[model samples]
Target: MPSTPLFSTYRQGENRVTSSMLAVFERVGLSVTETILARASGESTLETVVFTNQHSTGKGTVPDARIAADFTYLFEVKTARNAIQDPEQLTGHLQLLDEESGKKTSKRFLFVLTPDPVRPQIVEDLADMRVVWFNFAALHDAITEVLGDALSAPSERDRFLLRELQALFEAEGLISHDDVVVVAAGIAHAEYLENSAYICQPDRFFRPGLTHLGFYAGGAIQPQIARIHTLESRVLFTYAEADLRKTQGRNKARIGEVIRWALDTEVREEGEEYMVFLLSGPEDADTVRLSAPLVNDKVASSGRPWAWTMSQGYTSLVALTRPGVSRTSDLKQA
Candidate 1:
């Protein structure tokens, strides 16, 4: 027989991990509803939520439940280091839920508190079992979306709980603080763009070594915070269809054309180099690609380039970065 997996061993011997998982669910429910406290009268709040771990049934196996009502969810919480050894495990839980409820209504979900993305095969296997996978980052995104602009409200207790949750997520390698801030700023920026008469695109791209953050309205690479300064900066390059003399030089114009086209359309290529054009706007009113190194160099060479003034509308950026200095502020000071 094969050796048991580490997760199985941990589950059999330890209750603390299970307790923590339950706490995560509880905190998520609380944080999601914290904003409702500020809602106007007559505005409805979320339904009374409940999270129960290791719910008991008359049968040998028990499934997690909501509010101790009939089993409505089967939750398998995994720590950062553990991989799903048996995808069929969820199927067993599903069977147990069916046996207990006599009708199929319960949902199965796997909560991975890891920073890394789950393996595609594992995801597929879970899907086969009718199980939804909610990674830590996805959970954070859901919570943030639920809170909306109410995040700006001065609720220190709520903020502390959120920070603590984020700390746990970070320790498990779910996300970095910088990533959280950037995402928050991006959400705020997207809202700002929508309110400012710009059609913000839903597509965004971010990965290591990418020179730009992600695309926004008109395929603009909107950086949340600048590593160099808060002031806006611009780099201009003109492309003419007639200027195709040098074959090597034609690449720049080709790139420029792609950027222009991406603004009007969607570009979904992966990797670093192509991401620049993949997230740029049209040539007429081009969007700036906020590169820290380039911005720093511009600042060092000259006292705030004249083109910097062309970049504006950082209201969301300012709101997100307040109470703490960010790259945007750093660049402004520089």
Candidate 2:
């Protein structure tokens, strides 16, 4: 059997991604569009835009009025972080938006979308308030949340098109699905139980696409897997004692105490560098514990416990949370 592709094969990567996104927005109708725009721009102007599709007598009618936007939203899509660094492209787009936005009280936005977690330094330094920078992850989240709403009553066609867009995003490496990385808790097990954070060497890297962190202790994997925490206003920094004390305020002294206990050292070096992973549980809680622990049942033929040598492992959320998954080996990936 033969089938037609949802998006064009010969188009450029950015163009294809952009087209898929626009097609989904158009097909899903006005609510999704207004919700996304409200979230991206943090503006309430979408509420003021009146939409009607009925007769003068308030009876059901065909297209009494068409949905429209009072403002303009120009999207500049880039496949890679480096591609969006070209100042000329942004300047040209902003100039055109400005020309089209003349003598209007309504707002105009030039939304720059990229695959990077953060916008490029050029976009960050832009003085124009009309410019907004966002990543594909945010778009994915917004779309998923909107479609998952039961009250919104999304149609089957809407679901199919949006799912296709998500598939495209995953294929292009624009987003990563949730996965778990289980590592040895060691001395930091206590820290996890209390403060809900894990610290490791700065050079150590986890497997790609991991969104949650799990701990292995006492010949078993811990009950809970925590979602990695993020701060919108904070920049990345190393976990140095001096820096943490100076910048972390309130939690500084407590963090130092915990670090001392974890390291089991008397004199702490000021130059030590570690990457801190803050953890958040359900409802943004400080701690999380599962009903039961996941144990390692891989044993020798003689019925004695085998030598466990799991430093770290990766598993999907579906496998980890399944009811019959009792052994650590069942969830751990090679």
Candidate 3:
């Protein structure tokens, strides 16, 4: 991937893609392998015996390259979106290692690291190869070398088990707000965004209207009938790149939500649109109102303010406003 100066997804000066994220993936792989090998075989010392550009390590096994068998047990690592559903991909990599790794070692293992839990497909695939799949557990586990803290491990309620996370990453600056955003955004943009689940997160409260339905959720339910807290947590966001957009209000909370969801500067993919309602930004604060683009077309179906993209030649409706209303470009799917 080359750099595009016009594209905001990739920074102008930096590489087209962020290698730090790739490094994090590699780090996770190394940590998981170390932890698993340590726990299963009582082997702790590990090294990168193979390296490559496309493939992690080629199928060459150890001719002059294979590590000492007594010390190094060949680990076939497969990092996927989720191990459960995408088992064949995991098995495919293991099959390559099994035939290629010439030490002809027994007790060979296949490890699958997934963004989410391993699916049934992964479990079934591992059973056939006599290889076991250790999923989120390995990533969540403390390797005692890399992290030295247990930040990856889940907390029992409100408490985070940092002591254990320290043992795993061992690297400084491993976790932060930017880290979470990068990770989450990466997952959303990768192999799964095309899937429907990433586009919408509609709870009982949110009810998006189909084009024909005109926008109504039958009727609102009473709180007494059902009270669901943290509805945002339940949403599995899956949006089409084209349909994805963001709207921010003058209120910080509203803008924060929009920025969090719509910020295109991320690892996964860039968002479609981000509209902010600025109340005060070295400008007027009293009668701040929606300003439509001067060049408007009444013939357009949206009947909204439209701006033409010179690059694409697509006239995008920038915003829509009525007499005294500011129509937000917010996600109707909530």
Per-residue accuracy of model 3 over 53-143 as CA lDDT, tens digit each: 3442457643433332322233333332322455566567667666766465444455443322223344654665444444333343423
Off by over 4 Å in 1: 1-18, 27-71, 105-113, 149-159, 177-334
Which candidate achieves the best TM-score against the true structure? 2
Worst 10 residues of 1 by lDDT: 226-235
What Cα-based lDDT does every candidate model obtain?
0.37, 0.66, 0.30
- Highest lDDT among the candidates is held by which one? 2
Using lDDT as the yardstick, the better of models 2 and 3 is 2
For 1-334, candidate 1 gives per-residue lDDT tens digits of 2232211224331233445444544544543533332131112322234477777877897886646233344456565323566757666876766665664444332332333333324556455444445455555554454445664552555556555655555554444322211222334344333321112222333333222222222223244332211111221222332134235354344445443443334332222122122222222122332332122122335575333222222222222333333333353442
Candidate 2 has a TM-score of 0.50
Tell me the spans in candidate 2 whose CA falls farther than 4 Å from its real position. 1-6, 40-48, 51-68, 177-334
The full ranking of all candidates by lDDT, starting with the best, is 2, 1, 3
Model 3 spans with C-alpha error above 4 angstroms:
1-33, 36-67, 70-87, 144-334
Instruction: Report the Cα lDDT for residue 54, model 3.
Output: 40
